[model samples]
Target: MSLARPRALVFDWDNTLVDSWGTIHAALNTMFARMGHEPWTLDETQLKVRKSLRDAFPAMFGDRWEEARDLYLQAFEALHIERLSPLPDAEVLVQAIVARGHYLALVSNKTGRLLRDEVAALGWGHYFAKVIGAGDAVRDKPDRAPVDLALDGSGIAAGPAVWFVGDTGIDMACALNAGCVPILVHGPEGGLLRDEEFADATPARHFRDCMALAREISQ
Candidate 1:
């Protein structure tokens, strides 16, 4: 299926643009240890860690979820900037998209403060017109609220002319919910098994990585 050229693009932060699994895995384990739960293996972390803390913590940590949230945030804040790095060619992709004159924004499940900090740390604050993160919207990814917030003031309504790009099913679902085109960008980790991993949210197209997506977009 041919994708309509998007006038506006919304990106997910973590695995989509930056390689943050190491920091995220460590922080999650730190929280789990303090909460008296077993630590997840890196593989388990990759497989299961989705959803914002505000959305997922209560289910995992029960009445102590807020405490666990604090622990996780503390660990994440301490480690994130030091460990933060963009995925290969992700900057190239962003630049290419900007050169195409497409409106750009970010919608992430990461805490708003931390997400903004990472963008500034990477000197990428200028790329996105709006950077909506968890708690910035009434609901997180897979919900249309953040997407709507991200596009606010951009003069672009959510529709097929908007491309929501990310590395996870959550992002695809968010795009679908917002009536936008869902474009999946596989990071260095490679593509997901669509039938198994993306059963709930299918992408309109998948690229091997940011470079590949950039190449396609440039065409």
Candidate 2:
């Protein structure tokens, strides 16, 4: 990692900042059943599908994508609001990073509106200067377009001064694609991205959870 301090921190939602896996796993199974795919274990789901549904489902479902999208959204909508909760130390981490005068924003492939609502529901709207979600850019993370959008309105550009912190491979890919440093927060669940399949993904830093991340960044 660079000895240079970051001017800004970008976070990924879903399993990164919050714990929504219960709802997500359940909803994904329902959608998968509708799509004729078998239900995924939480681990498999985390590993296999990380993109915001609208952004990725089209490729997975093709001509039937929109229908699958609706089913997934319907399932997610029915449960996400009620199941959402901040991960351990998430609020503290965000506060600590911001208090240190670092600019902060969120970049997630989750649909833009849903991402906004989730942040608001968590009462975390204040910590972020911006939130970039799927459809907010022409292409989502792992594609660099959304990363560009996240850095778009910032006074700073994407580079060493920025770090994209999250739990999974997609988040790592976003940072890699954008040339931003990637920091992995192992998240509430045991991390799944450390697999050998991700050999090309070498995160600049790895913390067991957000609390560890907060401690490291605050120093």
Best by TM-score: 1
**lDDT of all predictions:** 0.92, 0.83
Give a tens-digit lDDT track for model 1, residues 43-137. 99988888999999999888998999999999999999999999999999999999999999999999999999999999999999999999999
Candidate 2 stretches with Cα past 4 Å from truth are: 187-194
Looking at model 2, residue 46 earns an lDDT score of 66
At residue 93, what lDDT does model 1 achieve? 98
Displacement of the residue 44 alpha carbon in candidate 1, Å: 0.5
Number of the predicted model whose lDDT against the real structure is largest: 1
| 1-219: candidate 2 lDDT, tens digit per residue | 445789988899888889878888898899999889888898887677787777678788899998988898889988888889999998999999989999899888888888899998888898898888888988878787876777777788988889989887778878888889988888334444557534677687778988898988789
- In candidate 2 the C-alpha lDDT for residue 57 amounts to 80
